[model samples]
Target chain A: EAGVTQSPTHLIKTRGQQATLRCSPISGHTSVYWYQQALGLGLQFLLWYDEGEERNRGNFPPRFSGRQFPNYSSELNVNALELEDSALYLCASSLGSGNVETQYFGPGTRLLVL
Target chain B: SQQGEEDPQALSIQEGENATMNCSYKTSINNLQWYRQNSGRGLVHLILIRSNEREKHSGRLRVTLDTSKKSSSLLITASRAADTASYFCATETWNTGNQFYFGTGTSLTVIP
Candidate 1:
């Protein structure tokens, strides 16, 4: 089976602009997770969507939001981007919620905000 | 931010040697997992150890979880140059089942 896939391997935007990143989970997976790996903050959880619902989120600000589609693919949106928002955004997928399952990740979208 | 902390932020060893990395978390977790990332690439799942389990092994990888200390360690034996990557430990807490808190990651460099 194909692994998780992400689009626009790299994104460039300026301050106050918005950025959208996409992710397609593996077949048969229902849970999609978003993470931000900043220069110093490491990899922090951004959002978790399970069965098309927002299950949980991380410490990120309201500007960072995303949604899961019916096909289990996900979209991460960063609004009013700041220079600090520049980082690698990763998307992962798992079997589903309520059980222990391995999470497979995508290559990640590197966003650079100037 | 219930993120975990990984010890020995960086490590460099010759091939055929053993590499061990440690992770410590803040809250109680249902399971702890290890992942490997090559530079800016996506992460690859290495191993997962449940709370009730103390130790588990797969191929040349061994993972040990200690709920008492809220810590876990990953051991990769007979390391090869291909094993050179950033290893991270993520935790799925009991309170938040879907969210995973990841550590800063330990960058390992295996020289051939």
Candidate 2:
């Protein structure tokens, strides 16, 4: 089975610009999660989407938002990007909230903000 | 901060030896999982131990959980150079809605 897949393996944006990262969950998965892995900040949860609803989000600012489509795909949008926004954004998916013990991750989209 | 913290920020060991890493989290969790990432890439799920469970093993990887201490440990036995990577512990808290927080990671280097 194909694992979670993400688009734009690498992205480059300038300060104050906006960036969009996409993720396609594995087949039959209903929950999609977004995370940011900065150099030293570790892996911080960004957003959680299950069944087309935004269940929860992390401590990130409002400028960081995302949505899940009907097909269980997700899109993460970072507005007013700053240099600090540069990091590898990872996407993961699971069966659902009831079976989230295991999450399969995508290769991640490396966003570099200049 | 629900993020977990891993001990021994880095470790270096020779191949065929054993490598152990520990993680401590802040809140109570439903389950804790271990993941491996090679060169800052996508993470590969290694093992998951439920709050009610104490230990689990997968191939050469062994995991132990101490809910009372809110800590978990990952042991990779008979390591190989290819096993070199950053190991992380992720916690799925009880109250959180399907959110899993991760640690800074333990960088393990297996020397040949």
Candidate 3:
């Protein structure tokens, strides 16, 4: 089966602009997760969507938000982007909403905020 | 803000050698996982060890979890040049079932 997929391989935006990253889960998967890997912050979970609902989120601010579609696909939107917001955004998909399942990731979308 | 730390930020070794990396977390967890990322691409799940389990192996990879110490270690034996990549450890807490907190990661470079 095909693995998770992400779009807009790379994105460039200004400080005040907004950037939207997209992710498509693997077939038969119902959980989608978003993570940000900044230069110094390492990899951190940004949001988690299970069965089309926002199940959990990280310590990020309101500017970082996302939603899951009926097909289990997800979209991550970062509003009022700041220079520090620039980083690699990754999307992962799992078979179910359970915590025991292994998550498969997609090629991250590199966002550069100038 | 909820994250762990991986020891030996970087490691460089020749082929046929063994590579070991350690991860330490602060909270109680249901399970701990290890992942590998090549370049800056997506991460691939390497192995996972549940809190109840002590050690698990997959081919050349062996993962051990010490729930008491809240630590985990990944050992790759007979490492090859193709194994060069960044390895990360993730922990899933009971409070946030769906959220997985990742560690800083260890970058390994295997010389051919």
Candidate 4:
């Protein structure tokens, strides 16, 4: 089976602009998660979508939002991007919305906000 | 904010030696997971141990969890250069579905 896949492996955007990163979850996976890994910073949870509903979110601002499609694929949109937004945005998928299941991640989209 | 904090921000060891990294969390968790990320790459799930479980092993990796201390340790035996990467510990609190808070991570370098 194919692993989680992300599009636009690398992206460049200017400050105040908007960027959209995409992720395709593995087949049979129902939970899609978005995380931001800024340089020198740990992975920060951005959002979690299960069965097409926004299940949970982290401390990120409302400018950081995303949605899960019926197919379980997800899109993370960062509006009014700031220079600090330059980081690797990762998408992970799990079998279900459970704490015990392991999450498989994609290669991630490296967004560089100039 | 990061819920977990890993010790020894970075570590270096020769191949064939052992590498151990520790993680401490602030809140009670239902389970803890370890992930590996190569430079410029995404993370890969390594293992998961529930709060009720004390230890778990997979291949050359061993993970121990202590709920009392709200911490966990990941040990890799006979490490290889391929193991060089950043390792992070993520925690899932009770009743939280698919929500995880990660630590700052430990950067490990296995010299050949």
- Model 4, A57-81: lDDT tens digits are 9899999999999999999999999
Candidate 2 chain A: worst-modelled 10 consecutive residues by lDDT: A94-103
True contacts kept of 2: 0.74
- Model-by-model lDDT, in order? 0.92, 0.94, 0.92, 0.93
lDDT of 2 by residue, B1-112 (tens): 7569998899999999999999999988989999999999999999999989999999999999999998999999999999999999999887786789899999999999
Total backbone collisions, model 3: 0
lDDT of 4 by residue, B1-112 (tens): 6889998899999999999999999888888999999996899999999989999999999999989998899999999999999999999887676689899999999999
Model 1, which residues run further than 4 Å from truth?
A: none
Taking all chains together, each candidate's TM-score versus the true structure is 0.97, 0.97, 0.97, 0.97
lDDT of 3 by residue, A22-73 (tens): 9999999999999999874468899999999998888899999999999999
Q: Which clashing pairs does model 4 show?
A: none
lDDT of 2 by residue, A1-114 (tens): 999999999999999999999999999999999999997557999999999999999999999999999999999999999999999999999999884459999999999999
The TM-score of predicted model 4 comes to 0.97
DockQ of each: 0.77, 0.75, 0.76, 0.84
CA deviation > 4 Å runs, candidate 2: none
The 10-residue segment with the lowest total lDDT in model 4 chain B: B92-101
